[model samples]
Target: MKYSIISILLSLITLFFSIKINLETLIDYLSTDGKSQAFHGLIELKYLYKYYFLILSFLSSLFLVFAFKINELKPFKHSAAFILILGIVSVFTAFWKWFI
Candidate 1:
């Protein structure tokens, strides 16, 4: 139960950070001039956010596995798994954006 609660808290924190970074990137993108063609700046931000997403994914996965193994947080097990999956998808999307 304790571990599950801790994992949930950590997942929430990771989510908060992820949202913050995404908003910052969006704001930067919107503020820039389309005619300026600031591709380089976007590329840099993409990489930066990609790594941040990766970190979130890692932390989420770690806690998710722990929660699964302990099997004590039955009520929250599914929620934790969902967060882990979402984090992974975000990481992949970030990487895809960087590559493309």
Candidate 2:
């Protein structure tokens, strides 16, 4: 149960960072000119960081789900479900950016 709570917390952290990086990327993309100068260091970092966070979020969410299932604690089940949904949404958002 403790591990599951920790995993959910980590997932939330990852989600936060992922969203932050995404917003920064969008702002940079919209503000930049047609020049390739925008693809420099920080932009590359943001791109890579977002994916890292997304991956972290997925792993943590998985851990939480597994732990919660093993414990079968009704109290935390709702929270676990919410985090799982959040993780799925984050995964979709991350992939959407890559594909589109």
Q: Write the per-residue lDDT of candidate 1 for residues 1-90, one digit (tens) a residue.
A: 665666676667666666566655665555667654457455445546445656656666676678788777577878776766665565
Best by TM-score: 1
lDDT of 2 by residue, 1-100 (tens): 7757767677677667656766666666666666754454455554764555666766777777777668856656567667756764764474324632
What is the lDDT for 26 in model 1?
Answer: 60
Screening candidate 1 with a backbone cut-off below 3 angstroms (N, C-alpha, C), the clashing residue pairs are none
Give Cα distance to truth, residue 98, candidate 2, Å.
Answer: 15
What TM-score, over all chains together, does every model reach?
Answer: 0.68, 0.60
Q: Report the Cα lDDT for residue 34, model 1.
A: 69
RMSD of each predicted structure: 4.4, 4.8
Span of 10 residues, lowest total lDDT, candidate 1: 91-100
How good is model 2 by TM-score? 0.60
| Total backbone collisions, model 1 | 0
